[model samples]
Target chain A: MAAFALGWLALWELAARAGWISRLFFPPPTTILLTLGRMLVTGNLAPALALTLYRLALGVAIGAGSGALLGWLMGSSRSVRLALDPIVTALHPLPKLAIFPIFLVLLGIGEASKVALVALTAFFPMVINTLAGVQQIDTTHWEAAANYGARGRALLQRIILPGSLPLVLVGLRLAVNGALMVTIAVEMLSAREGLGALIWLAWQTLRTEELYAVLLVIGVLGLASNSLLELTSQRLLPWKGET
Target chain B: MQITYRIAKYLKVVLAVLLLAACTPIGEPATPTPAPVLVRVGVLPFMSNAILKIADAEGFFVEQGLTVELVPFRSSNDFVPLLLQGELDVAAPALTAGFFNAIARGGNVKIALPLTAFTPQDCPVVVVLARKSDVEAGKYASPAQWKGATIGISLAGAQGLPGYVVDLFLRQAGLTAQDVTLTALDPAVQGEALRSQQVDLLYAAEPWITRLLAGDDVVVLSRAEDVAPDLTSSFMVYGPSLLAEPEVGRRFATAYLNAVRQYHEGKTPRNVELVAEYAGLETELVQQVCWSDIPLDGAVNVDSIMLYQEWLHDLGLLDRLLSADEFLATGFVEVPE
Candidate 1:
C-alpha cells in the first residue's frame, strides 16, 4: 500500500517536472500536498472532515443495527421474509442519486435529508448481508442455547448473535463505505458546507486548483475513516484478522 | 470489561460530537497569494484563430502583465456563473436570450469589443435553419417563414437566450415554445439530431450555419441577420473588477482585438495550427467554421440589451423590467477627445 502511494506520487511529480503534461490540467502531487498543508495550517479540515465521518458513523450504525435485527426476525419467521423479500427486491434497482430530488422535496434539503439519504444508501447492503448471515447461522445453536436455559434475549445474545456477527461485520464494512459515498453525494446536491460543496463551488467558479485541493482533502478524510473502521472490525473479531 | 465499555462510550460520544460540530460555522478560504492575475476568457471554436491562437501563443498577454486564458465552453451557461462571481475577467461570450444574463446577475461585465457590426440589410448572426420541407410547408422554407413555430436551439443555457424570438424577427407566427420542442442537444450532437429528424428547426449562429450550408442536403433557411436587422450576435464583455483595473482590462482587450485583427487579415499556417489545436478540429474544418463571425468594429448595442430586457421579461425570467441603461456595463472604450 505504501509503495503504491509513493510510486503514484513520484510519477505525478516527475510528469509535472518534465513538462510532459501541463501542470494546469493536472497539478503535481507536491502542489496538492502544499495546498493540503496550507489547509491544515489554516485549520480548514477538522469541521467538514468531522461531519463527514459523523454522518458515516450514524448512517452505518443505524443501517447495520436495524438491518441485523430485522434480518434475524425474518430468518425466524417465514411469513415476515416472504412479505419483505419482494418489496426489497422491487426497490433495489432504483438509482440512489436519482431519488435525491424526492428526498430534497420531501425533507426540505436539510441535514435530515442528507442523513436519510446516507442511511438509504447504506441500509441495503446491511439488510441483504444480515439476511444471508441469519439464514446460514446454524439452527442447532439456538436449540442448544435454549436447552441450557438461555431463553429469548439470552438465547439471542448467547448463541444467535455471535454466530451471525461475522456476516454482520461484512455487512457493516459495506455500509460504512456506502455511508461515506452517500454523505458526500448529498452534500454535493445542495449543502452550505462540507467537502462536496467545497468541490462543487470551486468547480462553478472555474477554480480547478481549489477544486482539486478540496477533492484531496475529501480523499484523505475518507481513507482515514475507512482505516479506522477496519481497525475497529479487527478488534471486534480478532480471529477474522488472523484468518 | 470496564475499559471496553469506556472505549465504546467515548467512541459514541466522539461520533455525536462530530455530527453536532457539523452544525457550526466554516471558515472560507482566505484570499490566497494573488494568482498570476489570471483572466478567464471564454472562447468559441469559431474564434480559435482570431482570439484563442493569439492568447495561447505570441506572448501578447504577457505584455499586459496578465495571463490571458480561455475557458472553451460549448454553451454560455458554463461561463455565466463564473462571470457573475468575478472569476472570469473577459468573455467573448455568446449572446443568450432576450436579456443579458451576465450583467443581470450583478456581474460587472461590459462589451469589451463589438463583434460584427449591425447593418439594416446585413445578415444577422443568429438564425433559424429548418428542413427545406418544413420551410416550404408554410413552415419556414426560408428565414422569412420562421415565425410561429418552435425552433430547436442546442444547449440548455441557450434556450433562455431568446434565439427563438430574435431570429424569427419577433413575428410571433403564433408558435409558442410548445409548438416546437427546443430540444436541448449540444451543438456537437446537432448533426445526429438533424439526421434523425428529432429536431424540425435549428437555431444556429454563423460557421455552424455556414458549415451546414456546405452540405447539399441542408439549405439556408434564414440568416440570423435576416430575422433581426439589429443586435449582432457576437460580443466581448469585461466585468467591473477587470474594467476597474484599467491597466489589466485594456491589455486583455487590446491583445484580444489584435488577435481578431490578425484573423481578419489572415493567419500564418503556424497560427492556423495553434487555433486548430484548441479548436479540436482539423485545419480544413477550422477553415470552414472560420470564414465569418468576424471581430468587427462596434460596441455592445443598446438595442440588443433592450431587446433582452423586454423579451426575457415577457418570458418571465426577470422580476423587475430593466431598461437598456440598467444592463449596459460601462468603462469599455473611451470616447474620442
Candidate 2:
C-alpha cells in the first residue's frame, strides 16, 4: 500500500514535471514534499496535530460517555426507548451545521462552538451503538442473573453490560471518526488553529502542493487513530468474532 | 463492565489533553522573515488559482525563474491560521489584508499585490428581495429591518464584507445586524434558500448574481463594487518568506504582469481551464470570471488598501493600523515600471 501510494506520488511529480497534468490542477509532488519537509523541520505540525487530536479526544470522550449512558438507560427500559427514539430521529437528521449562526450568537465563534459541533456529531453514532449493544443482551443471561439474585445495579453492570461490550465498541469507533471529522469541519469553518485550519489556509493561498501535504497529514492522522482504536477493541474483546 | 468504565475514564483524561492542545496557541506569531529565497505563494480557488496556473503551465514561472506552489482551502477561516503560521508564500483571500493582519501581531501575512481588481461585474453578487408591498414603499428601508432574510456567503468574508458595508449603509437610515437576521448559505444552496422564501437577500459572486439578475422576478439591490466601490473583491499577498525573496518576488511579479497582459489581450485559453478545474465547476463558469474592468496586473491598489485599513480599525481588527507603505513590499505596489 505504501509503495502504491509512493508510486502515485512519483507519477504525479513526474506528470507535473513532464507537463502532462496541468500543474495548475496539480503542482509537483516535490513541492509538496519540500513544503511538508519545511513544516516538519520547523515543528509547525506539532501544535496543529496536537490540537486536532485534543479536540477529537475531548469530543469522543464526552460524546461517547453521555451517549453510552443514555443508550443503556433507553435500551434496558422499553418505555424510555419508545418515547425518546422519535426525538432522536427527528433531531439527528437535521443538518448539524445549520446552527453555526446560532452558535456564533451564543458561543461567540470560539472553541466552545467547535467543540460543541464535534460533540454533537460524536453523540449520534455512540448513542446508536450503545443502544444496539445494550438492547442485544441475551434474554437467557437476564434469566440466569435473575436466578442468582442478580438485579438492579449488579445485574445491569455484570451481565447486561458485559454482553453488550462488542456492540458498544462498534458505536464508539464510529463516534471517534465522526469526532475527528467534525473538529476539522468546524475548525475549517472557524477557529484559530488545528490541521483542518491548515488545510483551509492552504486552499486560500493557492499553495497546491502544500494543500495536498495538509491532506496527507490529515489522512495519516485519521488512519493511525482508527487503527489504534481497532487494535484496542480487538485486544479487549478477544472472544468476539468479526461482524 | 467495570473494566470498560475504567478504560473509558482513562480515555477521558487522554482526550482532554488532546482537546486543549488543538486550542493552544504556539509557534512564532506572523511577522516578516529575517530573509527568504523561496517565493511561497498561497492561492484561493478559481481566478487566483487560474492566474497562478497560467504562470506555472505556460513557462511564465520558468521564464521568470520562479518556483510556485498552489494550496487548496475549503474556505477562508482555514486560511487564517495558515497565514498566521507563515506557512504560505502569498494569500489571495476573498477578504482584505487588514482583517488577516489583525488576528495576530506577527504571524499575519500582509497584502502584497492586487492581482485581481474589479468593477460591477467582477465581484461578489448580492441581490435584495422583498414583498411587493415593501419595494413599493420606495423609501429604501433598512435591509437590517428586512427580517427573515436569507443571505449567501461562502464564509464570513463573503458575508462580512457585503453585510458589513451594507449594514453601515442601512444603519445610516436606522438599523443594525440585530434588525435583520441573516441566515448564511453556500452558493449551491442559495437558489433553494431564495426560492423557498428562506431568505430575503442573497449575496454571492457572479454567475449566480448574473443568472439571478437575468431572471425577470428578483430585484437587484446593489452591486458589490457599487456598495463598496473602493473595496477589492479579491487580491494577492505574499507570506513572510515569499515577500522577503527579492529575486523570486521580482520574477514572480514580472511573470504575473505578463500573464495579465496576455489575459487582457485575450491571448490565454488555459487560464480559464485552470480556473474551472480549481473551482470544482464547469469551464463556462470559470470563463464567466472575466478580469474585472479594472487592471489585472499585480499592482497593489493604494485606495483599496487604505479602505481596508479603515475597515480593520473600525471592526477593531488591528492593534495599530499600519500604513500602506508599511504593510506592503515595493514588489507588490510597484509594477516594475
Candidate 3:
C-alpha cells in the first residue's frame, strides 16, 4: 500500500511538473509538503490543529455519551423508543450545516456555537447505530441471564453490555468522524483559527499550495483516527473472530 | 441472394440522398450581420454596480454592438476564481490583498475601469459607526478610545478596503490594528452585532449604514473619506477572454464610461428607477441611501491603489506587490478632455 501510494504521488508530481494539469489549482505534492513543513516551523499549524482536535474531542464525548445512554433506554423500553423514534427520524436527515446559523444565534458566535454544532451533528449517527446494536442483542442472552437470578444492573452489565459491545464501538467510530467533520465546517463558517479556517483563508488569498497543505493535514487526521478506532475494535472484540 | 439485393437497394438510396445534399445551395449570399459580442459580467447587487445596469438599460451596450449578461454573485470569493478562469468576462470587485496576490500569481485578469472611490464632497457612503451607548458613555468618543475595542468588518483579516479604511482611521489617533480586535461579520448582520454590543465599532457602507442610523442606536464615528481622500475602493476588471478581444474590451469600456456619464447626472428619475430595479430596492430607499462615486472619465487613482498594495504588503497579507502596469490594462477607453 505504501509503495502504491508513493507511485500515485510520483505520477501526480510528474503531471504537475510537466504541465499536464494546472499547477495553480493542483499544486505538486512536493510543493504542498514543503509548504506544510514551513507552516509547522513557523508555528502556524500546531495551534490550529490543537484547537480542532480539542473541539472534536469535547463534541464527541458529549454526543456519544448522551447518544449511547438514550439508545440503551430506547432499545430496552418500547415507550421510549416510540417517543424518540419520530423526532430522530425527522431530524437525522437534516443537513447539520444548514442549521448552523441557529446555533450561532443561540450560543452567541463563539466556541460554544461551534462545539454545539459538532455535538448535534455527531449525535444522530451514534444514537441510531447504538440502538440497532442494542436491539440486535440475542434474546437468549437476556433470558439466560435472568434465569441465573440476574436482575436490572446485573443483567445489563453481564449480558446487554457484552452483547452490544461491537455495535457500540461502531456508533462511537461514526460519532467521532461526524464530530470532526462538523467541527471543521463550523470553524470555516465562523472561526479565526483551525484547519478549516486556514483552508478558507488560503483559498481567499489564492494560495493553492497552502490550501493543499491544510487538506493533507485534515486527510491524515481522518485516516489516523479511523485507524485507531479500528485497532480498538479489534482488541475489544477478539472473540467475535477474524470474520 | 435476397440479402445482396436488399443491400444494393439501400446503397442506391443512400447515394442518391448524398448526391442531392452535395448539390443543394445552403443559402443565398448576402451582407453578413455580425452578432453582438456577448460579455458575461459578474456583479453584486450594490449601488456601486449601477453603471453596468445603466449601460444595459439605456442601450449604451447595444449602441456599442455588445450584449451584456449580468450574473449576480454573493461574494468576491465566489466569483473571483471564475474571473481568473475567464468564465466571467468582466467584474467590478473591491480592491483586496487577495486580488493582488492572484494577479501576482499569473491570474489573467486586469483592471479596466475605475468603479467607486471616496471623494471629499460625496455623501459619506462608507463610515465607522460606534454603539450609541458606548458613544454616550464616552467609551469610544475618539479614535484613541478604540483601543481594546472589538470592531466588526465585512471581510476577514487586514486584506481588503475595509481593513485599509480601519487602519487609516486608527492611524489618525496614532494607533494601529494591534490596539483593537477585528472581527469578521457579515455586513447584513453587522447592525445586529453593534446593537447587541457584540462589536464596539462597525466598518460598514451604505444601506446598512442608512438602516442602522435610522434606528438611533449607532452614531457615525468617522467617514472613510475624511481619512483617505480620493481612495479608490473598487474597479471594473476584464478577464482573459475580454482582454484577448481588444475591440470587445474597448466597446465594453465605451459603454461603461457612457453609463458613468449618466450615473453622474445625479438622482434623475430615470437613474433612480434603474438603480432601484437593478439593486432590488424601492426607489424611495434607493434615493435615501448615499451612492458611490465613479469618475466621469473612468480613470483609476494609481497612487491610492499603490498605497493600498504597499499597506497590505506591510501587513504580510499579500504574497507580493503588483506594479500598476502589471494589473492595469490601459488604452481601453480615452480619458475625457
TM-score between model 1 and native = 0.49
The share of true interface contacts that also appear in candidate 3 amounts to: 0.22
Q: Provide the overall lDDT of each model, using Cα atoms, as 2-decimal numbers.
A: 0.62, 0.65, 0.85
Task: Indicate whether candidate 1 or candidate 3 has the larger DockQ.
Answer: 3
Off by over 4 Å in 3: A1-4, A145-151, A241-243, B1-33, B155-157, B268-270, B282-284
Best by TM-score: 3
Q: Write candidate 2's Cα lDDT for A1-243 as tens digits.
A: 999999998998899889886564377978877878887888467789889888878877888889888888888888999999898778777677777556555553346666777888888887788888887788888889889998789977897688888888888888888788778887777644688767765554344566688788888888998788788788878887444
Residues A1-243, candidate 1, lDDT per residue (tens digit)? 999999988998899879776554466877777767776678446676677767767777776678777777776678999999888778767788778756655553346667877887778888787788778978787677767888778867776677777887788778877777778877665553677755654444334455678787777766886687678778977888832
User: Per-residue lDDT for B4 in model 3?
Assistant: 100
DockQ of each: 0.01, 0.03, 0.24
Please give the lDDT score at residue B130 for candidate 2: 37
Looking at model 3, residue B33 earns an lDDT score of: 69
lDDT of 1 at A82: 100
The residue-by-residue lDDT of candidate 1 on B1-337, one tens digit each, is 9999999999999999998999778798576643456887766666432465665586777655677667666555455455655667676655543225334434455666665543444344455566766545665533334434444564333334444444244454534444344544445545444644656667676557666767655655655554455554556767657767876776676666656666656557766677667666678766555344453443566676566556655754454565556555555455333
- Lowest lDDT sum, 10 consecutive residues, model 3 chain B, at B152-161
Cα lDDT tens digits, model 3, B1-337, are 9999999999999999999999998888786867899999999988888779999999999999999999998676756678877789999776666678778877788899999889887578999998888788988766788889898886454457788889999999999989998887766567877887777888988878888998988899899999888887889999999889999999999999899999999999999999999989888888999998888887888899999889988977788888899889998978655
Residue B286 error, candidate 2, Å: 3.5
Question: What 10-residue stretch in candidate 2 chain B is worst by lDDT?
Answer: B96-105
